[model samples]
Target: MLEVKNLYKEFNNRPILKDISFTLKDGEIMTIVGPSGAGKTTLLRIIAGLETKDSGEILIDSQAYDSGKVGVVFQDYNLFPNLNVLQNITLAPTMVLKESKEEANKKAYELLNRLQMNGREKQYPYELSGGQKQRVAIARALAMKPRILCYDEPTSALDPNLRKEVEKMILGLKKSGLTQLIITHDLQFAENVADQMLKVQPLSEG
Candidate 1:
């Protein structure tokens, strides 16, 4: 299970997240929903270790994740322009995980297959469409094999046709039993995939 306690964050004396707390179980898809600027993204960043919390504890399966064990899928693909699809996924594992090039390539190939990116390995980011790049982004995160997956308004930036494709991919991950925490304003995405939903409202706003 993942547990968060007394989370707090501030910037320039303005509170972004205030005393937020929650727990999430493994294999569960928990979504955080609310209006814009409600601290949803801030909370996810803190949980992902992309941002520092003023005070609180984030734990995953009894291990502290102050450095963050979760993987985040940003709205933008966050891909490197110079790398091909396959290289983007393979580089991190062999480089950061210190696995052999052979071993990393094998895992990368498997993940590419699982991510339905067959025959597209040589494609550059500029060559692929937005939805496709986002799909690659998702695959790259999965290749890392994180303990928790966090998505922030994943499909919000895509057009409807493009959005459905990304939506289907996320749904596919859930069907295969990936543990996820999503923050989105899109209610349909939550209704279609979330195992549990929590609406975050500030202490005085509600």
Candidate 2:
């Protein structure tokens, strides 16, 4: 379970988020939806440890959250342009986790197979479609074995068909008992897959 308690954050003495709290149980999908400047991404970033919160407590499984326990897939699908899909997915496991190259590659292949991205291993990011890139990004994140998986604006540039693919993919992950957090402007998409919904409003400027 993930619990965020009374989170507060500010920049330049201006508040971005204030007194925000939520709980996401394990094997659940929680989607955060809001308009622009609503701090949706900021909250996600804080959870992923990409940004600092002025004050808050983030706990997973009733203990303090570790950034390593979270894996984030950015809006732009931040796959390395120069690396092939297989290399990208296996990079972290080999380097960060110090797993053997063969072991990392084996795990990457398994993830790719699950994502239906088999045979695209040698393809680079530029050679793939938006949806394909997103799948690779997801596979890369999953390879890290995070306790909670997060997506930022996952359907931003996807066509309707591709969006549906994402919806199905998320549902499949849930079946495997993965905890997920998603930040998206697409309310309908959020409704389609989220086990719970959180609506965030922008903090009024002082």
Candidate 3:
């Protein structure tokens, strides 16, 4: 559903992404694997439209969705701290999608249910466990209903065992037929859930 070509980005004359290009097919889960400073997150941001590429093209469903078109699950779980789970999840639907309050709330509730946060709708981000908070972040993104979902190492903070819970939620999204690109250092998670892997190739010496 998405394609990118010849993507290049630079910081202070140093390249962050060099000739990065790929496609995310419909209903397929693709994982971007690389070490730190490999431009994984920058690639996600550029594709999401949050950041601009110095040179490249991105197509979403035959049109351009920018990096902003990709729904993000960042490691920090950027929730509005004061907004409860349901409110946080419904914000985009109401503001961006222009749905009515009742409509947004209905969709929010259903999403929370699917994410297993049904009765916790009234809870604030600070009130939840780390996993619960990440779940809310997932629900918030899914409620946006983006055709492409991008995750930036969503399990970075959890204990290894707790990491599995968040991984399960992400894996489940893949099973539900969502098109996704996950940037991760955790190869185990990638091997378990990704349909294909995009490992960052080495930069050649001058």
Candidate 4:
């Protein structure tokens, strides 16, 4: 389970997220929706340890938030431009987790196959389509063995058809019992995938 309490954030003395609180149970998908600049991504970043929160408490599975236990898939799919898909997925596991090359490669190959990205191991980020890149990004995150998976604007770069494919992929993850947190402006996608949807309203600077 994930618990966020009294979350607050600001930039340059201006409030962004104010007193945001929520709880996400295991095997559930929660989507945070709001307009751009509403700090939806910031909330995810804070949870992912990419950014710090001004004030809040985040607990994952009864423990404090840890980068190793959380995985984030950014909107741009942030794969290394120079690395092939397999290398990109295995980089973190080998570096951070200190897994051996053989072990990391085995896990990466299995994840790629599960994500239906088996044949693209040797392909560079530039060669893959948008959806394929997203899948690779997801596979990289999964390689981390994170207890919680978060996505920022997952479908913003895809066309309608590709969006549906990604949607199915997310649903498949949910069925496989992964806890997920998604930040998106795509209402229909949220409605289709979210077990619960929360709107992030911009804080008023009265």
Q: Which one is best on TM-score?
A: 2
Clashes of each: 0, 0, 5, 0
Q: Write the per-residue lDDT of candidate 3 for residues 32-106, one digit (tens) a residue.
A: 998887888888888877788899888898885554467888888899997989899998889988999999899
Better of 3 and 4 by lDDT: 4
Q: Which consecutive 10 residues in model 1 have the weakest lDDT in total?
A: 197-206
Models 1 onward score TM values of 0.92, 0.98, 0.93, 0.97
The 10-residue segment of model 4 with minimum total lDDT is 60-69
lDDT of each: 0.81, 0.94, 0.84, 0.92
Is candidate 2 or 3 superior in lDDT? 2
Clash number for candidate 2:
0
Ranking by lDDT: 2, 4, 3, 1
Between candidates 2 and 4, the one scoring higher on TM-score is 2
The segments of candidate 1 whose C-alpha lies over 4 angstroms from its true place after superposition are: 66-68, 202-206
Task: State the lDDT of candidate 2 residue by residue for 44-68, as single tens digits.
Answer: 9999999998998899889977999
TM-score of 3: 0.93
lDDT tens string, model 1, 1-206? Answer: 78989888888777778877888888888989988888898898888888888988888888867343677788786898899998888778777778788887787778778778888889999998777787778777877778888988887878877666766777788778788899999888787778789788654442
Task: Return whichever of 2 and 3 wins on TM-score.
Answer: 2
